[model samples]
Target: MAFEIVRQECMKNPEGRSRPCNPEEICEVLENNQGSDAIQGISLDLSQVGDLQLSADVFRKMPNLMFLKFYSVGVKRSCSVKLPSGLESFSNSLSHLKILWNGVKNFGNLREINLAESKQLTALPDFSAAQNLKHVDLCGNIKSLKSENQLKSLAKLIVVGCYGLKEFSFSSDKITYLDLRPTSVEILDFSTGCMEKLQYLVLNCSRLKYLPINDICCMRRLQSLVLYDIGGLIDKSKLHSLFDALLSLKVIHLDGAFKLTDLPNNTKHLSRLRCLCVSNCKSLQSLSELPPSIEKLGAYECSSLRTLQLTSHFEPSSLADKKLLGPTLCYSVSYLRNLQRLTLKGCEQLYELPEFMDSLSSLSSLDLSESNVESLPASIKHLSNLKQNFLAGLKKTSFSARIAAIPRNC
Candidate 1:
């Protein structure tokens, strides 16, 4: 009865039979390999009846399998194996189907899939014939697409850290690279039309609010935009024209946007921006209209921003957009001259440390943890390959006099 074997051609079901069998007479008697590390008995029931796990009696005897993979039980399985229904002739009988850790509900000629760490999966089935899927990694599942049309024929989907997803139905514009980072998505509605071939949009720590970006500008070939820890009701002035129609943006990451404050004015049209990261924006104060093809800038702990103006002191008048007062916010470190790596940890009203700092001299690596920094502005020795320097929550008498004048490469 069971005879499906793609690529090696055997398939014969709709009645025209060619049933044959013999995976050692329906698996269960093994020894040749001596129970390869026992995940179960008869060598995993003779590898689910020969050549890698496949149950339901291999559709009566090979129905045209192009490929079928099923490790079906690992992660210390005690019970996880009950997914083998007579797939409606699985897309004309298999092209490639991979089901692991069991629990899966059905099968389709999957294009490519990896249900890694299927922590007792929750939901995922009704796959409309997989429709030539491209790539899918249901990393550590807790499934929640409830059937967004069974993901309309995915292109590339990586649902990393899926904490019981609550929603994601922007349709499916042949997804380009949509990683709902560190998911727990609050409210994301990519304005319909199913994501018009989204380019690269990472919504990290999605606790979003009002993130429509004018419908994500219909993903006009979006380049890269990652927003992290997006806390409540976001409206950072439409985040600079919501990528001003993307025009192939470079890279922009607004980390831990704690109720973001401001950054709009079309952010100088991105102008092929390089990399700009506003970290832990504790109500970020200002950095208005930044756009000089920025080269990596990670504003640490924001702390109500203080100062950092380039392009000739960025004179945008009105008391330099006042409000930014304490917890120091870079009042000018030579305007991050091609900043390499700078993370002023927990800037606690930074205690003066920017005396004409040789324009970061392409600073290498610096993470002044929990600052209250007492001293160390000997121009930081112009960070020549500055190694690892983390002055952990200083105060020990200026932490040994700024850790002895930064020579250990900082």
Candidate 2:
């Protein structure tokens, strides 16, 4: 009973046998099974073949066609489909292909092409003879993209939400991961060199204006720089010369930039910075003094932070010791000694914090929730790996003598 050949039941409609076939009755049932070389695979559902127009050798007599899937459920991008301008007659045994049918111009041994959310795809199709393409997941409404040369085995390129991609250029020097998030790309032109082994770059474009920070400071094996919500068209001296030429940056997410305010005093010499996220940076007020190989620090809802100065020659005299060493409570004092996790949640103009917090010996989570910090620093019982201390929106309740100076298994 293995007569299972359901190419949509060969578009059956001998008077509506469970009706579901148009597009010239499924191109005349693939032109009468073009001699069928035992058709290897073909899964078409372009919304029940609504507007297909095949015949560029309609699968050239199915010579062992590998796999071809054209899916569409709830379709309607004007239901237009026109395949074949380089399935190039199944270039010697077609490999695998999913279709939105823009007539891919030959990518024979295809290795990957997601075509994410096609959204009436705008253009792409000249992958210079693909040569075993590596990875390309493009997002909706792509406006522009130029490649045509130097894709020597692409490594990874994800273009998300292409708004109308303002401008982008690539040549691929073995790209190591480039995510253009929320794109309306305002000219990114990676200075040709093609991101020399780039190691992860997510540009959350807020209409990014331009970027060529000396060819992204010659890459130097970039290690993760997500400019989430990048606004103000990048400035702050080119993000402090791209954090002093990306000294092998470990991770830096400037969440919702909002015109910064301060950060580059050589950001305490990024000695392989571990992680720093300036969450919702509502015009950051001060920070400069961090890189003690940070472990994880998130300044949530910044709201014009005050002056977080941990060290760099600690000098706090007054103004309430600089609002208890502002910037929502600085770090550094003996260099975060490997900070574990410290999130200043909604820093409501942070009131105070630094009584040197016992030099954070590998701090283990401390989030001052909705902060306006009233008090808490008798070195907080010398943290011995404090485990999660998130004071719920404190404005005052004068924490019973700092909760009896913490440490009762904190």
Stretches > 4 Å off in candidate 1: 1-128, 131-194, 197-217, 220-243, 247-313, 317-333, 337-362, 366-410
State the TM-score for model 2: 0.32
TM-score of 1: 0.31
Question: Model 2: runs farther than 4 Å from truth?
Answer: 1-24, 28-40, 43-66, 69-125, 128-177, 180-200, 203-213, 217-224, 227-240, 244-251, 254-264, 268-275, 278-353, 356-375, 378-401, 404-410
Q: Write the per-residue lDDT of candidate 1 for residues 1-410, one digit (tens) a residue.
A: 22343212323212222222334422322212111111111113333333433333333233233233334333432423342432222222222233332344444544555544444446665555557566666644454554445456677777777776767654564778877778776666665455667778888756544567677777887788887777654556666567677867788888777767667767766667777777888877666646646666667787876544443234333454334322223343244556576666675555545566555567676676675666766766656666644455455326566666565444
lDDT (tens digit, per residue) of candidate 2 on 238-279: 888988888888998887777788787777778898998888
lDDT computed for candidate 1: 0.56
RMSD of 2: 15.9
Worst-scoring 10-residue span by lDDT in model 1: 33-42
How far out, in Å, is residue 165 in model 2? 25
TM-score on alpha carbons, each prediction: 0.31, 0.32
CA shift at 119, candidate 1, in angstroms?
30
The 0-to-1 C-alpha lDDT of every candidate, in the order given, reads 0.56, 0.69
